[model samples]
Target: MLSGFSSHWHYLWLVAASLIAGVMNAMAGGGSFLSFPAMLSMGILPVQANATNTVALWPGQLTSLAALKSDLRKDLLPVAALASILGGLTGAEVLLRTRQVTFLHLIPWLLLMGAVIFGISGPVSRWLRARSAEPHAKRTPRYFPLFCALFPVCFYIGYFGAGGGFLIMTVLALFGVDEMHALNAMKIVTACLSNLVAIITFIVRGAVLWHYCLISMVFAALGGYIGARYARRMNPDVLRRIVVLTGCVISAYFFWRQY
Candidate 1:
């Protein structure tokens, strides 16, 4: 049995981290920078921590998908759905098979990659937003090409998603879907669906630590709700910068920890 005060502090730490993660997610879009590390700090194994983090943050995406369901393009759905399912399942299975220490060593590099991707997205997002107002003829994207573009990113999402959502949005924009509504909607659907299968894979493989997962999920949900209320009042650009900075800082910390 653990010492009483120490155990209480551990839970309190998780609660604080999860609340901030939820708020960050609702405000900007980088909660994993907080929640995933919180899982690691709890002494959970690397693979299980990643799986639990994915599971914990998933419910929020469902609400987003529901709210944005109307904006989803029927044409793109087939490609996004197929890619997310196949890639996510494959990624989760691969993660499960990864040796614990190997995953541990990879944490810094993965976090760095996510952070760098997020930093680049700031410009891409603005470009997409500006491009959204212009009218363009509808173009049909080939299923195979679109699937090829999305599959590896979806696999990264299932494996250790931090900033993969923007990558999906970028891919969609490149495929001639510049409208933010559709891009955002499809990103959430792809993420939610992909994460859904990974969640199942982790659960079946017995990789998630349920007690922490449940707590983080509940508190993160609460945080999202609270953050949503104030999201409109806050400046999105500022929030985005903060999130980017947080990801980079966290990535650096992980690098420091490893080396």
Candidate 2:
């Protein structure tokens, strides 16, 4: 148990972390990169921290989704939603079955992969735009193939979810959904669904730290609002770079500690 001062400091730290996470999530897609470490630093166990992080960041995701509701409705695809929900359920089940040691071992690789994906997002986006502009270029393949591709991405989101939004945006872009706002909207919806299933599983299994989750959620939502309001002034490329750097540093630190 924490002493009074320690407890106060922990909460303060969490509030600051969640607020940054919300801004990062709104600007780019790496909120988990902040919130997860914050919890771990507070002596929360890995599994509990993951569960609590999901719950804490969930409300901010919902807020983003609400803001993007119009765009989502305009370009929403049923198959994508179905794939995300199904994959998320499967991934959450897998996470529940995982041992703490195993999850600790996996964290570095997951973070590395998320970082690589985020780092390449800009180039990938540019390439997609170029391809889309070409004459007689194919926009998207068939629904089955797209569904298959999105399933694993959603599964990852359910399991760890650090940079899942970048992956989702890439997939959507490949599917010929080139509008930035639409892509972001779809990313938020898919992420929200993935977290929804995982949070339910965490709740059922008694894994979530509800008090911390509640505190982070409120602050994260506030951050999301602030980020959205100031989005025009923020550079997404800079934010993406920061997220990539943070992911690499965190991954390296965890790797060293665990190994």
Candidate 3:
């Protein structure tokens, strides 16, 4: 009884972290940089923390999708959806089979990579925008190539999830999707689908902490609503910088912990 009580207290911060994660995801795109490390700091095993984080944030991603429904392009939907499902399932299987020590060793590098990706997102977005504006520019790559590219990205989403949206946006931009709203809309759909499969896999494997997942889900959903409503008022560039800094700090700390 006392242990359960203490466990509850230990997870209180997950609620706060998830709320902030939801807001950050809504405003910018790097919530996992916050949520994943927060769980790790609470002494959750790396794989369990990742699974729990995915379950906690899945609802919020769906909420964002609902809010961005009008922005989604039908032409880009079917193939990406298939890739997301297949890749997510494959990635979840891989994660479940991985040893805890292996995941722990890989955490720092993954976090660092995620940080670098977030840091350069703005510049990349601008470049994609310029390229999209050229009169003779190719609007999209052939469908097969785009589908192939999204496979690895969706796999990463199911495997780790941190900064996955940024990766998705980068791929979409390369596919000639330069409109900010449209890119975000596709990101939301793909993330939601990918996370859905991951969540199912984690649940079946008993990797998620149900109590923590439930609490975080509620708070994240609330944060998503508030963040979406106030998105225009927030400076996304500032939020992006903060996320990048936080990712760097978390990565350094995890490196120290692991080594």
Candidate 4:
């Protein structure tokens, strides 16, 4: 009843939607706002959709971490990586154990929360920048305290990552990471590690729907490459606003669909 088989059309839609999501993430953040739902619409169950989405978008985070490697706070990397792995594995396990219907019910709330956090990130960054303007002592990062703070954020990233990167940056700033590059570098590292562990968990548990995940991953990479070229020329603030708005609107739509 269509131009091609239903399966082919669905794959086409997933590819196109993932391309746009990648562009959004490269320009700003919040690609999951599109990619997760695209997986769902393809009839993947909620938990699997989430797992597949996480796996699909993970390489970009790795790419970022690679580029920022020189700025990584070496003093903080061990604890951060440990926390990310522990929390990410726990979150992925919980997601896998969750009943399908319950996860579907929680989707809107998760999306809304991610959007709200993202909306506040810009203001929080400005505050960090202003505070960094002052001369302050180089406080040694409290490893335990920093890990405690980051565990939940990385767990959330593993569960449903949209705005978790910003949360990591904010937490790092709060814990005396004064250099912007260091903060960015650490954020990417933790996020990448979080996803890496989750990806492993998903594969071990057979949660990722690879048929869709593969297409999403390839197209998203292409989109990221293309978007990165134009990102420097665009106003980041404007793009951030657009990403936040898109997340909010999509969350609202999901909420309506649920209730």
Best by lDDT: 1
| lDDT of candidates 1 onward, in order | 0.91, 0.81, 0.84, 0.89
Global CA lDDT of candidate 3, please?
A: 0.84
TM-score for each of the candidates: 0.97, 0.88, 0.89, 0.96
- The parts of candidate 2 lying over 4 Å away from their true place are 1-7, 73-76, 129-141
Model 3, span 1-259: residue lDDT tens: 9988877766777778888888887788788887887787678888898899889888776666787999987888987898899989998989988999999999999999989988998898777667656554335457788889999999999998777887888998877787777788898899889989988999999999887778778888887777888989978788889989999999999889877
* Displacement of the residue 211 alpha carbon in candidate 4, Å: 1.0
Deviation of model 2 at 118, angstroms: 1.3
- Whichever of 2 and 4 has more TM-score, that candidate is 4
Which of the predicted structures, 1 or 2, would earn the higher TM-score when compared with the native? 1
Q: Rank the candidates by lDDT, best first.
A: 1, 4, 3, 2
Candidate 3 residue-wise lDDT at 4: 87
For residues 1-259, what per-residue lDDT tens digits would candidate 1 score against the true structure?
A: 5687777887888888899999988888889988988898888999999999999999998888899999999888888999999999998999999999999999988887887888788888999999998998877788999999999999999899889899999999999997889999999999888899999999999998999999999999999999989999999878888888888898899889889
User: Of the candidates shown, which would achieve the greatest TM-score relative to the real structure?
Assistant: 1
Angstrom error of the Cα, residue 158, model 3: value is 0.6
How does residue 154 of candidate 2 score in lDDT?
Answer: 89
Q: What is the C-alpha RMSD of each candidate to the true structure, in Å?
A: 1.4, 2.6, 2.5, 1.5
lDDT of 4: 0.89
Error of 2 at 168 (Å): 2.0
Q: Count clashing pairs, candidate 3.
A: 0
lDDT of 2: 0.81
